[model samples]
Target: MHPEVAQLIERSHRLGADPTITNYAGGNASCKGAEPDPVTGSDVELLWVKGSGGDLGTLTEAGLAVLRLDRMRALVDVYPGVEREDEMVAAFDFCLHGKGGAAPSIDTAMHGLVDAPHVDHLHPDAGIAFAAAADGEALTKECFGDRVAWVPWRRPGFQLGLDIARIHAEHPEAIGVVLGGHGITAWGATSQECEEHALEIIRACQAYIERNGRPDPFGPVVAGYEPMPPEERRARAAALAPLIRGLASTDRPQVGHYTDSDAVLDFVAREHHPRLAALGTSCPDHFLRTKVRPLVLDLPATAPLAEVEERLRALHAAYRDDYRAYYERYADDATPAMRGADPAIVLVPGVGMFSFGKDKQTARVAGEFYVNAINVMRGAEAISTYRPIEEREKFRIEYWALEEAKLARMPKPKPLATRVAFVTGAGSGIGRAIAERLAAEGACVVVADLNTEAAAEVAKGIGGTDVAVPVSVDVTDEEQVQAALDEAALAFGGVDLVVNNAGLSISRPLLETTTADWDVQHRVMARGSFLVSRAAAAAMIAQGLGGDIIYISSKNGVFAGPNNVAYGAAKADQAHQVRLLAAELGEHGIRVNGINPDGVVRGSGIFASGWGAQRAAVYGVPEEKLGEYYAQRTLLKKEVLPEHVAAAVVALTAGDLAQTTGLHIPVDSGVAAAFLR
Candidate 1:
């Protein structure tokens, strides 16, 4: 790679990594450098810019769009003006250097047309504060004087690029310009100079705001609007998350993220929150992720839970209706159909914020973007009135043809993409495999286990907080089970899939199976499954999204194996719970099923905990050969592995067996006695 290209990537990373500099996937950087031409064997000037839909912090060579500078500049002559500027994006492909690196973004023209070696376009909260202010031009002049220019609001397109180019050419002494109601753009003769200039402007703007800003910018907190205590706040957030998620997913299912950060809490509890939130986010990137604005739940934080829920439901319905009307008012013959009328963000006085999207990362990012908007609002309102772009302009960007085309280009979602799974005993063995498999198929998993450390390790391996979260729970404790479900709701909206896999085995004859042993086994297996399923059922029902409940029952439940009285009875109880719940939950679209595996000794937590040796002694087979002995009795002569059981779970929930419920699928490698009759 050329030195400048490497430096550009490094520069992008430095700027993108800081939230104060830019948001995730929100900015673009470019460098103009010479590369050897394959055909001509001569150095040709190329513009390598951050590609569309790529995050700068994680950018690589593959994420940069390489375009021939000469061809890119030539498009200016054929530019059809602002009304037809979108056509210029298609023309970028023709300006590609070779096959191009990645798809060029809408801002490609901004970098390519600028008359500088390096250019950086970013959305720093401080800079956008000035841009989003009512008297933004005057504020820009007051803060930076002639060093940074100010341009009036204009949608990103060829015309805006041309506008910035003209500004750059007109003011040779200026380091950058704050685009009105948008973001900041800086350029330099060298990569280092460009990065320095961008930082300088951002830092200066931040300093200016801090030095001159007024106190209580969002206004003083209203009575009863102060944030609740930490524990109580989270508890409230947990209780409301599923209902909020259900409302947000009315048009399409969405994963959720919650934040009770000081910034969100302070903003939400303040007197000006309703007004500023209704004004909506100023930046296109912010509003696109956060919707036009948030749906703020009216009423003080001290309201009764029932009253709060009632208000939220009414508010959500009004939000949807208002969103639909907003779309209808601005839409034209060529506009893309309204994607969905549901709000992506929700705010409650004491409860902070909840943001939703098709996946956890997106949902989390949406909340982050809203926080950025809050920061921008603070700075703007501190110095001057916050004045975002008009709603029509926001609608234009939100429903842009290019954005719709980008959405169309996205790959189809995985089968379990929007679903959240709660897997008990996911620390090891079959439960761990099931958790990992569900995540691979795109479900967000809650790895619940009595072994906290083990559960955390498994969750980390599956992709950390974004894809999986760990919860320590003793399944026998109903309170712990309920808390785990609440954690699931707080972590990813609500539960859509529950795997009752936490179990133990105490193999012994009736005489040897003491009352203590019998009670312990039943308590962990039967009562545990009941507790988890009941709590999860409430969450799923609250979400109003149908869900799946799977039990990892064993062949011992039906096969009546010797020296297994206590264990077999518990398994039998679980198997029956599946049938009974399946019959009951079908109306709510909840499918309850069971997987009966004969003898899963390898990687079996139960076997490792002494059950294997006892069972081996009973069958007169070596402990190590127990799996083989069980397989020998099977028609397929195959040892049932944890992965096999995990696969059975995927089969039941991944849609092919959607209509199949109240079923018991045996994963005992074709054990005749274990077959469900």
Candidate 2:
């Protein structure tokens, strides 16, 4: 058998067991390694082909059947029928009968059309984005433009075989062929060449979508939601100019608008309200990349652009809330096949479509996906039917146990599974107990405090890390915090449990707070929180590892942190940052959250260290009384311990909370959940 075919079968068998490449076991390949394996003496010029029921990524030599190259070429002109195709397949399989129970790949006939020794084929999810389009052929040629050749979708049989032969005869130099609604066929003199061709075809299709047909940034315009007024938009645009330009990643930011008149709006929005969002994309690949819909709105002539912009913000917020609710609903009420990430939709009100991305490339990629989705929606609408995967089936595929297992097994610094955690400031102390408990649960504990020596002693006693490593890091210094996190990453390859345990608590009347104190609080509370989270996020994103970030935020952030101006405001900012990071990086698979533990202690590093104790003394409570006082204030009537908070943190980062992200899980007990308005 050809060595190339041998490798292809070997590769297929390996991946076949993986659920991610589930369902479709079909693929093809050719390689320069197409040499006969010397058995005894006679020359064996047989082709190694992937057999049916084989996964391309996990195959072995035994998984392929050998067919004489000359024989296959001879059959091309024979105008073989289904009977012949079956016989060919059975005969091919028979050749490798002693090798294993493996069968022959379905496209064995087409394999003869290629002269290259190396070849490969697979029905990649991304490749099909363009292949299954209503204008699949036209779009394929337009995007690839002569870089590759294409064949119309034909029923796979004798006629299809003849068509492929004709196309090959015409475009002899073409190294690859893509059949609409089918799969691609790539070949090369060497295995590398064939693989590269496959990669390039995918890249070209993805690149074309990223370039030619992207969606808008703002979102699909909504009813009563018009474009920002010229002056208002200009002003807001300027506000964003600095940040947007920094992240634009282009010579120029292609900022633009899409405001549909009543006619266009009515045309799309007439019968199908929500379904109209899908009309913007042209294919199914878009669904895989950008979800299946966008948002739509109606804009009023008199509404101020600023007001409309504000409403848009509300819309985004509402969408997120609905997303969470939908996930919870599907998960709790009944089985809705496990939905993957709640897909972002194109909002198409008065504003045509608002495309979003961290950079121009991402935005453009997302836009192309959106356009294809629109096409799918439009085509299906023509038939008065447009359906994505059946809900349960979609859920099953999205949340396939195999896929879920694969996602769980994603490469990471370390396998962070089934571990417990301990956080410091246990009890009325929010961050502490989190640290202490996570440690008790098997992790090397991390004790953080302004009392450097005290924390060191705690570390020695807690003994979580080979005995918790004692290190003093002020939350404010980016360098110090980042270095500490780096140390942790290096020490353990990665950190599975984290409790943003260090914080400050100052209850000064907002108006009377001094500027120095305010700035210090901001540096310690808000900026410090940002630095640590940023460092952790970078690490997690790099390895595609998802972990838990339990920000020891106070209930004050959610319930209007009063009296304490600097502390409350800083903590509030921390909470918001958690949400933003969650939304932006969810695709990368990282999750963020805030833990409102109410109160821990006055002498905690945040408030007691430096100004923390002084601030606490002014409130007339000795540092010792701080913990109990806060605990008594809770509705649970039970004290909130650092261990309790730590346990919660551990559960979240562990397998128990696999799909949970962007949550504000309140560990303040039942009391905090019903905090007084």
Report lDDT (CA) for all predictions.
0.94, 0.52
Per lDDT, the best of the predicted structures is 1
Clashes of 1: 0
Query: TM-score: which candidate is best?
Result: 1
Could you tell me how far off, in angstroms, the CA of residue 396 lies in candidate 1 after the best superposition? 0.6
Query: How well does candidate 2 match the true structure in TM-score terms?
Result: 0.37
* RMSD each, Å: 0.9, 15.7
What is candidate 1's local distance difference test score?
0.94
Q: Which ten residues in a row have the lowest lDDT in candidate 1?
A: 668-677
* Model 1 per-residue lDDT tens digits across residues 1-677: 98999999999999999987899999999999998888999999999999999999999999999999999999999998888889999999999998899999999999999999999999999999999999989999998999999999999989889999999999999999999999999999999999999999999999999999998999998999999998899999898898889889999999999999999999988999999999999999999999999999989988999899999899999998999999999999999989999999999888889999999999999999999999999999998999999999999999999999989999999999999999999999999999999999999999999999999999999996999999999999999998999999999998999999999888888888899999999999999999999999988888888899999999888987888899999999999999999999999999999999888989988899999999999999899999999999999999999999999999999999999888889998888877777
Clashes of each: 0, 118
How well does candidate 2 score on lDDT at residue 591? 72
Instruction: Give candidate 1's TM-score.
Output: 0.99
